[model samples]
Target chain A: MPEDSKRPDEKNLPRFRPATDILERADGFYLYLDLPGVSRENLVLDVKDAELMVSGRTDYRFEPEERLLESEFGNVEYVCSFTLSDIVDAESVTANLRNGVLEIFIPKTSKTIPRRIQVEYQGE
Target chain B: MVIDFGGFGRPYRLINELWKPSFLSQQSLAYPPLNLSENASAIYVRAEIPGVGPDDLDLVLTEKNLIVKGERRVEKGRYFRQERPAGGFQRMVALSAPVDADNVRALLRDGLLTVVLPKAQPKSPRKILVQHG
Candidate 1:
């Protein structure tokens, strides 16, 4: 696979940092990224060494006969990264993209979750 | 505003949080960035609107103008970083050429909206050969 088409990483074009929201829960963490114009096939996600990287590219190709009158969006890329803690179980991470938004699930280890400890009636 | 992650402080750090390029900063707030184009037979309009469904969008096309209105709703939750704004927006664009109102088509897929309007009359040009007198 050619290095250019295979990966979402692009250096020559302009890149934008996607607007993001990170929600935390006892069970796991949910990350939402607004990546408009990026298709499912153009998204790239990687988790390595406690770091999560997300990159997406949008392609805007005009036909030969079409003439652009007004322009705002063009060929651009979206990139955002996050640093995960040790408690986060990287192997179980999962993600999905829908309606141009990317959702990532980062589950933590069972030991990290706060739990109620059952105590015997030894005080009685 | 930044929020703490489970009271353990903000574990997630965005390295590029302040690295916004000036060229696109103003364009970001202008919701639903659009592209208007036209060919010999039809006009095209495309808008990038993520997280919005077909029901949330309303489009009105007339002889000389096109109006787009839509709402983008974000789920309520405890957010550590909230950057994507959620609200309703309306934008009106002027059409360069007249179009067939009855034949306009709108399609939504993966958060991109594409509208095609066929021209009122076919503008295919013909070459007339000049004969020697």
Candidate 2:
């Protein structure tokens, strides 16, 4: 009977820190994730409580019909994940995948948004 | 940016070119590079082809080998920083075990291309008849 086994040092959880650009604006934050070999079908985007998790995989296995001379990183499977903070908007989160890049727009929470509050004058 | 992996005097040399830089290409996307794994059944491979479309890619399997050719074209009307490799890229890999080509599947999402190659069936076992010779 075959069984699933891994080295004790191997971590079962997926770990991904996509290349991101946090442009802090007066309104929101933009996060860009580099996810290649992942399709809309295989990708999972979820926000539980205050945590955000994105996971996907890339499979590149073909039959043995041709001759290969040199191979690069193109044959490995890909899996990655990330965590979100309270400042990130969960309900309004939007993600798009095009040309192998995953771009996510995360607006800031209402409390985190910068606002100009007028201070009342109380001169004693 | 095109990075030629070079070839051994072959007609078509293997190369890697990206017309636009993907989020993964950026220093920020800290995903692990491409990797490989194997089991008694078959071998598996995953490649990160960020910013590359399916039409621009070509996968060729010939004579006990595999070849992946594709181009990463930059989106038109961009000029801030053009560091992405534009044009064409190719990766050649050696096949360690037999594969089921007809049943292979490829899926692309999040700028990544996943190829599934199944292992070939093992040879059938045979019974020996060692009678008094």
Candidate 3:
């Protein structure tokens, strides 16, 4: 059948690495991951043993009778992990997924936050 | 702070190498990955484009080709690792059958852009009946 012929190679489908952007600021770090086709329901983010693990499953599937003319975006699992540093306040880390893009905010620890010191002048 | 790919080690590398052929072929075709499918009466096209809004997309359909153009804007930040490509991209896909451009419908959801193009009516084969003498 033409539909069967167009079926994706599911057996060989590779776990894709989502493109990520990590930015550092004075207060914290911002992580942006491009995860197209992955909805919030399928996404999973966790921190274990000082590692930030991000994984999700995309829900792009074809019908049994549908004929695929071009096959570029295949259904696959997304997996990527990053090691967290001591400077990051793990307790305050927050993440939000919008439009299939996952944004993670890792605030810096108290020691990392810059502090201003007041000076007292002594009269001679 | 440095970010590294943990658990993506030797085994993952081996699997990636095995999958490189297909992946390379797709990358050679267009910027954003696309999927095109067709049924008896309609053709559907989907492109993967995360972080892009509806306002940033421009779609045009002709008799033989469907053109998609869009831009992905990058937020301002100090980068440590920037892998997602940002900028303008355009792609024109040739249709296998004639489509009604005016009836086409497009939807953008969850970072996937899907365009449904209704197919024009095809000429049906006529049957001939044998006459008994």
Query: Which candidate has the highest lDDT of all?
Result: 3
* Candidate 2 docking DockQ: 0.14
TM-score of each: 0.75, 0.45, 0.80
By lDDT rank, best first, the candidates go 3, 1, 2
Q: What is the C-alpha local distance difference test score of candidate 1?
A: 0.74
Full-model lDDT, candidate 3: 0.78
* Regions of model 3 farther than 4 Å from truth: A1-13, A112-124, B7-29, B123-133
Off by over 4 Å in 2: A1-33, A37-95, A103-124, B1-33, B125-133
Model 3 preserves the real interface contacts to a fraction of 0.78
The count of backbone overlaps in candidate 2 is 44
lDDT of 3 by residue, B56-78 (tens): 99998877999999999987878
Q: Give the CA lDDT, 0 to 100, for residue B83 in model 2.
A: 34
lDDT of 2 by residue, B45-65 (tens): 556678766787788987577
lDDT, candidate 3, A1-124, per-residue tens: 1222233434444576787898987778999998888889888999987889998877776545668776665666688888987767888889999888999999888876544588999999
Segments in model 1 whose C-alpha atoms lie over 4 Å from true places: A1-11, A113-124, B1-29, B122-133
Error of 3 at A113 (Å): 5.8
